[model samples]
Target: MTRLLFAALLAAIPLTAPAAPSDPYPSTYAPVPSPPVLIRNATVLTGSGERLDNADVLMQDGKIAAVGAGLTAPANAQVIDGTGRWVTPGIIDVHSHLGVYPSPGVNAHNDGNEMTSPTTPEVWAEHSITPQDPGFGTALAGGVTTMQLLPGSANLIGGRGVTVRNVYANTYQGMKFPGAPWGVKMACGENPKRVYGGKGSAPSTRMGNVAGYRADFIAAQDYMRAWDKYNAGDKKGDPPSRDLAKETLMGVLKGEILVHIHCYRADEMAIMLDLAKEFGFRISAFHHGVEAYKIADRLAAEGVCGALWADWWGFKMESLDGIQENIALVDRPEKGCAIVHSDSSEGIQRLNQEAAKVMGNARRVNIDIPPERAIRWLTQNPARALGIGDRTGTLAPGKMADVVLWNGTPFSVYAKAEKVFMDGALMYDRGDKSRQPVSDFMLGQEAAP
Candidate 1:
């Protein structure tokens, strides 16, 4: 053939066919419809380190329309008198196990882990989530509009975690946060070593745990190379057999999925960061990191967040050195990304109080964190950790109108979320009994929340 004809034929032929799409279990979450609303004369914590007093927030089309002092309300808006009320972006919990380990706490409800293997990245937490969990309702009562449901840390790599809008739905996919990135659950130090050690597995020691992670990533690297070669049409063969675990790990290697590690010790966290460096992947956040205070500067420098508890510690050796001011210390460093996460079902319902504990302790130590700055721990910081920072965390114009109207300052023990809005739709109201969402599991119970 002529040179022009040969080039034309080459262009006409397709390069190669790709494997199946990465996300099989995708989000089906759609925001509830809402009318225009104007909450005026309120103290607003924008979740972006800005506090606006006597200001108004206008929402239209399920987004923040405006936020400022003396803003004119739309003619068709439902104006809420925010006298003496505090407004904030809806609380976002970076770590929660609500749906996976649903309430009623029976062995049958215990589905947060697939401990049969030390590395089971193939299994997703959403597959095991029970959308009827009553804890989600209680969390809404506490102003949690979004949360990440994670698997248990009983292995080296637990599985994929799913971020969900805290909305009532029959299916887990209905609650999945739209466009949220997937997170892989990893554990360092004790949990992995202990769980597998008792059963006499490969990862019986801390070093063994590290080895397990390295071995898996090495396999993931090879798997990634095979797929790359096939996709580039450099090799002439069908695509390599798909390994679900390696697919997830390869997503991490390719920077598609975020990495959330359940690590307590500062040393273990450092080691995990080094491991990520070795494998050329990123560590998004360290969940339940009790020793995060010891290396706050390092975490800040690396742009990794610490999703931590306010005071819970000392239940085990790895978490023994935890302090009441752990969260505060983590937030002390400049550019630090510190988040207050609720690992407990009960704790999820009191995330504001959890943040309050950190603020109170911080004040005692003279490291004052104002309401504007502290709100980020429960809102902006968690949103960023879950890779949804640009969407729902802040009260900026054009962002999702997920908001809470508290009867008092949220940090005060007496404060209560009087009204909660998700996507500008009123999801919960303390005054209206009908607006109080009760899960089907709690419908007939005498002590229903």
Candidate 2:
């Protein structure tokens, strides 16, 4: 009778979802079908600091079958003469606002920041993604295969950032990367202070920012303890009420979600690092860290990556000390993870050129950043920072065949991506008008040619 009564009580209480949802807004991405192909006699930058001249790349069954010299093509493969071209893994932009703050920028499209509160971790950047934002096609034309779409830096704990494939889809879910982890966006330095300060808020100063983080994390800790107790069967009462913001924070505490913070000053980054230590969460990368060079060695030792612009600076006080050699300096440490990222849509179209600018600056300092090594800023390092390093960054056997055929050395201003492939499928061709993807939003709006 006691067992029967307990079963009835359990049935009367609502069943709560698991701590981590397995498929809430799950990815529905599907790679475009492709066939075997071979590109012979090209200069290949493997994206792992290895360059091979007169090499051949094989693509079959939606993966990089092989990369070598004097390799024979399969009988059914379409052969291409890569005589004067260069091949590199497709570019991956670690910082981007492509869909959230999409093109034809207007008041209606301004959905990036949920500024009603300072700590709104419940919000998600993917919810604002408009797949028909013409930016995707333009980015693809520039050889970008994957990108992390993030929220604007307006709040202390802004929201969740999503990693997505630069592919055309009717819905953002179809563009989401299947197994990519979510990133929580946090900001430090000027933006948050200035924003809330003018509004007569608590976090009008840097200390206030630190306090805000601590308070929220403390609440999250309590929330986690409640759930943990229930899961461990230590609590006989009903399971604790779920808080979306706390759930997101608990994901960070559990190392399920990556932390990407927007910080400019070195001291503030150090403070953030200390805060992470207090909360027991890991930071994946620091975005737009102009002062990252000041603590390059420490960041390398901690295994944190710096996703920064090549030369952008001086527009704001925090960015005033930024130098052109920032990327190179941050990359000086033995284990330094440096990535060149485009936070602007216009810059996203010329990420290779941005890396070239860094290369030029590094050369002036006698840093000697070669093409092979510099390519890591665009490919491997960004992939590692975004938690997709094992799958898509380098051209390796069994990896995604995201390759770009450049008309010349990619570092040169004259170079262009002649052909762009994602998962062995030809997604863009510079010479083929039909192959160019036009967004549905741009269909009838294109000016007459």
Candidate 3:
């Protein structure tokens, strides 16, 4: 009787186990198809100065598999009808402080500068990156797929900066640009001196600034010698205890890292070039080179790229002589050594417009820089500076599918980013106006539609 009662109760209650609690939002995002995606009937800018009209581009497994006209998609491929739009490789910013100085604009959030000392080669910028910063989304909206988040120029040897993908993610490691070489942020002239001098430090003058750099590099050279002896099995005992600062500097000496120096004046830039020669290290690029036009030929001869602002000058003593023809003069046909850059959060959003302004200035000065070449300032040139040229900057087969589709000519004042893709994934699509990636922190805080 008892067995029968138990069996009856079990049968009366639900025999099927209660449905396990699931995520109300089960991973609905579909995986990228293997056969690839086909974008048809669009204008393609190959980043090699080649433009294709009514072109077809295919992306497979996160890479550009094919690009041309009259190409057919695979049977199971996803298709995007690009009736009328301009497609170009994703924009790269060699000098950016996005994650380090993330948005929400708070003093507590500032992480780009380790101003505790005038030389902090021990620090690493990637360690300070806040991947969940809202500014990542803003940069994505502007079609910036990859960027190098650099440490500030507050010190002579600021530290190592890291390059990262502008993917919406929760961890910095998840967004790090795979295999991108780290960069050392070195500064010259006013910034370091001013930062330290005001605080009653050694570098109170320009000469002092140079001395500080020389001293650090000299020490770095000695540090390298120690490491070399240890590595070559010539030195015994303790292996010269690991020094993070010297490790970073040795990376530069070994050519495993790139050097990005920030300077404003022409003479200071020349001094930095000489310093590079003295130290036997390459000067990858000069950031905020407002006076680069004054010695554009020298910069080109040294194989150094100048990152400048379009029409940004006269705000400081060093930039008093700045002119609109800066980009034009540096980008002269015989001396192609100029690139427009945006160090400001707002300016970064419209790098295309900044390049356009430089183009306009160049045209006015009778310098016939083609629109394609000017576009290089925001795309190809920066990729070269950041050392990711072969990967994401160009729309070539076997390259990552970092592409941007514009509503109009990217140079136009009214042009806007219509769609953006990173690694064959549709990260931003204005066509789907309803779907936008917002951080968890912004979920209910933002006003609803």
Candidate 4:
């Protein structure tokens, strides 16, 4: 649906206030605004299933001006020589934990999990985000232009995740991606059960998990109705006393916020889908969906994305059925929304390589996956999942000039992102000491961040 119609629909639902509330923490994402530039004579992967050998990509005022062969450089546009290099949209990691669980992992840094309860939608990942986390620069150096910082899976509802531009800043808001819809992070399987069950808590089993979600969503539905009556002018008194947690839940039900769940098993994922149907909400993506191959058609039918790792398997009981061919199998159908995600800090650095691995795995299974098509697992697909497809994720005209220059074929093991741009501004240059970013936390510990 168009954003206008969606907004009108959102307005129809009873909200605590406006759907787009003044961000208590607003983004400080001011573009440095690079000059118009012409990147010529490169192998361009446009993220639209088209590869152009010896192409020219033009950028003007931080947006793609044009992309094709023999594109003329506008007046005084800086010309970038891209001979023998590969240019594509900067890689986007849909799942990440760069800030909340920053580098130099320590018990003191364990802020990802809010284990006080199975549901804590009142919390937000941005509040706990430490912008000085060196991991941001590391991922940026690896060509990650955008990512979402999600809450860990310890809770049945682990607060909200923040989508961000991979920029180094002093505050989390400074790094927040502009106009990105927030997502609620929820989980279905072992994590919630184990954590609460270990404490002799309520959700000691999978059944308990389902019951908890139902109870909470039911409460939210009732809450919405109450305010809805008031907003409709039939009710008497002022608005119902605000419930931060319930407010977020209502947002999901009203389609104001996206639902990104961490689910592994196919049975549990199906159950989650049923729960979403029951509550009248949408499940955007199933993070770490190891067994999604079993229900790939169901997910595609529902237009839900499966944000999964390329080959992560067997670390836990829920993940035992995972296969390296999981992504390949899910991507087999033309309708499937197969995504390559990294739940780990280390893995986020090379999401391109991870997608490449999935492409290779698919080819080995006699499935011919072309580079242009496979690159979507790293770019436009993730953007579409994140609800930012119109702005970034491709080299299309008027999209953000978030481009990456690879030293070799991006799918090859020997490849490296020699240059990375965000909004046409040079952010990371492997050959230049001046352009690389270094976070405050790593000022003394590490030299090149």
**By descending lDDT, how would the candidates be arranged?**
2, 1, 4, 3
Worst lDDT 10-window in candidate 4: 1-10
TM-score of 3: 0.89
Candidate lDDT (C-alpha), each: 0.89, 0.90, 0.79, 0.86
Candidate no. 2 TM-score: 0.94
* Structural similarity to truth (TM-score) of each candidate: 0.94, 0.94, 0.89, 0.94
- Residue pairs with backbone overlap in model 2: none
Please give the lDDT score at residue 302 for candidate 2.
Answer: 94
lDDT digits (tens) for residues 168-230 of candidate 4? 665777678877999999999999999999999979999999999999999999999988989
How many clashing residue pairs appear in each of the predictions shown?
A: 0, 0, 0, 0
Ten consecutive residues with minimal summed lDDT in candidate 2?
A: 1-10
- Candidate 1 residue runs with Cα over 4 Å from true position: 1-21, 234-236
Cα deviation at 68, candidate 3, in Å, is 1.8
The candidate scoring highest on lDDT is 2
Model 4: how far residue 287 lies from native, Å: 0.7
lDDT of 3 by residue, 1-449 (tens): 12233223324432222212321111111222234788898888877667888998898887988999988898878888877778888888888888788877799888899999889988988888886677777777888888888999899999998878776555665567766778999988778888999999979899998998888888889999988888788566668877888888888888878999888899999999998889999988998888898999988877788988999888878878888988888865654657777787778888888888888887887877666677677777788888888887888999988888888678889888888877786777766643345654455575657
